[model samples]
Target chain A: MATLIRYALLLATTAVLQRLLLDQIRIADVAADGFLVLSVATGVVAGSRRGAVVGFAAGLALDLMVLTPFGLGALSSLVAGAVAGSLERLIVHSARTLTLAVGFASAFVGVLFFVLVGSLLGGVGLVDGHLPVILLLVPATTAVLVLPVRRLIRWAEAPSRALSPALR
Target chain B: MILLLLTAVTLLTLSGRGFGPLDSVRSAVGSVLAPVGDAASWATRPFSNAWDSAFSHDDLVAANQRLQEENDRLQGQVTQSAIATEQLQELLALVSIPFVGDTPVAHTRVVAGTAGNFGDTVELDKGSDAGIEVGMPVITGRGLIGRVRLVSASRSTVELVTGGGFKVGFLVIGTSAVGVAQGDGDPSRLRGANIDIAQPVTEGQIVVTAGLRGSSFPPNIPIGSIASVRSDDAARQSTVDIDLYASTRDLTYADVVLWKAAN
Candidate 1:
């Protein structure tokens, strides 16, 4: 329950941040992919299933919150979450550097998926002549954000696990 | 993964097809989330404002340019006022005719902004309950913005003039030429069609609503100013490019004109 609430707050905060503030703050004329980073980070930490859940929720919020295609965000997020989770399954846990690597890679996968999917969805010029900048920003921004986001999700999930058997 | 992926694909298909049944769902979700979106904007207002102030040197410079224009206009207004007063005093010696009438109008605030880069609509705080119909024009002090595209009980959707499907009958101000201004799926660029080849159109010529009978918009609202004009000799018509005065990027409020087309 605590984890659910924490993730919910995180999703809402990220959506709100992206929409009202960050969308206006353009870097190289492209908005930073906030929800994608969060989804990828969550997937890496919580496993693929939980990560997909977060991605789906955030995607739905994104669709409803803004005027993009109704299902595009959800689709992109689902893939992101699943990819990160699959990566988690391959590596042994508990190495800080590995976590960061996973985070960066997850972010890259999520962003690349969104860009490709968005373009294919008939977004015509969805690349907007800024694909180079966007591609560079995606992994770069994701790298910058991965560790912090992973930490936040970890922080949120930690107490729940410790208190779980005790409280129930 | 498969199930979630399938579900997402189905939803995407339905959304892309614009299935009518799902409109209510979109509206419901939009209605539910509207408050949250507003709260987000409200919370970030101060920060965006401060950031724009502190770090936006280019914006500040552009703002100064606007201020300079406003100053010159205000100075012109002072001269016009003095001239108008003298004219009014002279007119007092003659008979006066006062004309007055009111057009139907319903003022509304913009509730939510464009959805994304591809967003072509804006959500309004007013809906059918306020007598906003699907075709009523939306306007601001500057000029025509768009028309009502969708309306629910407590909210409505406005199709900005920049939408791919949007078009308007436009008159080139100070010239006899008229043309159909249309959106090219690019918000910043509007294309004008059917401009008579013989009509000389220059850059920066203002355009306004034709207000033709049976049209959605009323007459004489400014649409945009001409940006470019090119003659297609084979077609015997000059293609004119227009730049709209209203941009959804910074819009926060609009008025829903209650006027309907006269059948």
Candidate 2:
């Protein structure tokens, strides 16, 4: 389907950006998580299942460049995307403040979940003592990304679905 | 979503248990993306540099002033080197001992570093094809970087000293203080524990590699400087903190010591 191909391209593009470009752009030594933003954005517009799937694919692509357990990245992005996507049920607006709020919250919460899971799995180093910055940045980045991501999802998804009442 | 989570958890468990398939997946994925990552890294370098330069104007001014002072000092050293060159000929005749820290090395540019915030590894442009091997210490002009961890024909991964898995035998320079220093997941600092109780300690002292028996690093390679020293008399030891001199944020190139020569 066109949707699948579209998401596949997005996944690869974001992964490449995160792995190659954004990784080097550290603000205060903390690199912005590009995949996290896209994953949350996809979930916000495409609904939970698609969001989770896109996030997992993106996360797997990310795993190739990182040293975490094979699926750890997948898990983090999956939870974030899934939870954020599911929020579409509560709010009707797909491409506005509602989606941004969900995406921002998802990015922040998902990273917290990642750190918590990492700590439990003996990856305490993953926390890195920059909890405040990481937490703040994830959502801060999400805020910047929401509008662009919404437009991207609208272009990628079926026109009718994208143009539904909630999104308008 | 639940099923996906379960599947991901399963994969993590399997990888943690050392599953071969997972290794293959990781290797294959890494190999496939390494080039892409390399290209991307190479392409974005300008933006990264621009961002840093644009933001660090004051630091640049200070650094420029420092460089001016160093240039003046080096000119003096150049003058002294000519006179010292005459004495060195006589000293060389008297002593045939090898000089410390004169090892031959290969300088390579970093292609791709770890993408996220957590991992402290980097991909080098050179690899086994260039005679870079595992266990070789990587350094920059400033100080220690890390060591080669994984290698391929044309690319290799350097596990930075700040990585969670790295540990180094540490020594406080110009003093008898010795201890174990390991990364605390922060690139700017290392945690030093179990300093010898008898060795006197103080703030702002330099720290270097102890390079004890069986240690990978050569003796006395500068690592960082002591930021603080706190004593724990009950445990008969002191904890020291080291401030890393080499900034990982700006690390662009490193020299790999081939380790064939002791010096």
Candidate 3:
């Protein structure tokens, strides 16, 4: 129950931040993907089921906002979160490199999955020509931010874990 | 069981089947979440305001001076106001569509945004209780921003034109070059496709919303201007770059175009 509450709070907080703050802060019209970073981080720290659950919730929250056919984001995030969670199993140490690598890969897959599903919906076109560039940049960008994000996630989750016996 | 139930709910909604419970669930969730969103927005409002203040200092000063000069010039034109008012009255009389409608403009504040790298949406502080609904077109003095994608009782989400899935039919002012403008997931970048090669397209051409057949958008609303145009023989279709007139960076408020087409 405590784990569930933590997941819910984390998901809600990230959704609120993405909606309220991050979207306004653009550098040359590019805003950081705070939710994606958090999703990956949550997956790495909390394990696969929790990660996938949070990712799905977050993505569904996004689907409610955009015009795209619903389920595209939810599915993509679910898959990305699961992959990140499994990756955590392989790495013995949750070092900066491991976290970054997982984050970079997950972000790339998440974006790609969304684009592919969206294009198939026939509602609008993807930035098909820039796919390669986005693919390259998203992972690299996520990787660069992973260290700091990992630290923040650790700090936030530690107290919650201590408070909740289920976290053990 | 929870995953299965969630998936079932999601699938049902996605398939266009009416999930009666979904609306209630969404409303309950929205009301509970609205305050948190509002508080977050309030916290960040100062930072954005500070950024805008610092960035627009010089420009604001120059603009103030220019406005002062323009005011002086416009003072002379005020003498002909009687004649202009008569002309305006005549034009108003000529318009066939009823200007008066049920839709009332309600101001809303930004509450939140869509999550992840697909950053193309913002949440508003207003919701169904405020008479907002999905498909309501959102705008500002500059031009169109987007439409309300979803609404709860106390909060709503707006999909901006900078999102990947947004598309608007547009026309290049001087030429009959019609194309579809799509968001490049970046506000500074927009793409217009389906232009005919023979059409005389040029840089800096004005683009306006080419209202679709029986669509809600009023025709000729300024959409953007062509930043660049490209033609390739291989593709047989030209692409034009558009620079949006409205800056999402400085967005504060938007008007919900409440004119729903009469059935």
Across the candidates, what are chain A's individual TM-scores?
A: 0.81, 0.85, 0.79
- TM-score, candidate 1, first chain: 0.81
* Clash pairs (backbone) in predicted model 2: B103-B263
lDDT of 2 by residue, A1-168 (tens): 667767788777787777766776667667778777777878887878887987887777766667777788888888888878887667854457676678778888778877788777776467666777878886777657766877787777865554355444
Predicted candidate 2 versus true structure: per-residue lDDT over B88-163, tens digit per residue: 5566448552322466788899877676877688888887788987778888877887888666667778888887
Judged by whole-model lDDT over C-alpha atoms, candidate 2 comes out at 0.77
* TM-score per candidate, chains pooled: 0.71, 0.80, 0.69
List residue ranges in candidate 2 displaced over 4 A: A1-3, A24-26, A92-95, A154-168, B14-31, B34-62, B75-103, B112-114, B173-177, B213-216, B260-263
For candidate 1, list the clashing residue pairs, or say none. A66-B115, A67-B115
Q: Residues B1-263, candidate 1, lDDT per residue (tens digit)?
A: 67778877888788778776566666666666567657766786798788878899798999999999998999989889879756755663363311111366778888666554444678888788899887888988677888886677778778788765678998897788988887765667788999899888999999988776666777667788999999999988998889888775668889888888888
TM-score, candidate 3, is 0.69
Find the candidate with the highest lDDT and give its number: 2
Q: What's the best-to-worst order under TM-score?
A: 2, 1, 3
Q: Of 1 and 3, which scores higher on DockQ?
A: 1
> What is candidate 1's CAPRI-style docking category based on DockQ?
acceptable
- In terms of lDDT, model 1 sits at 0.74
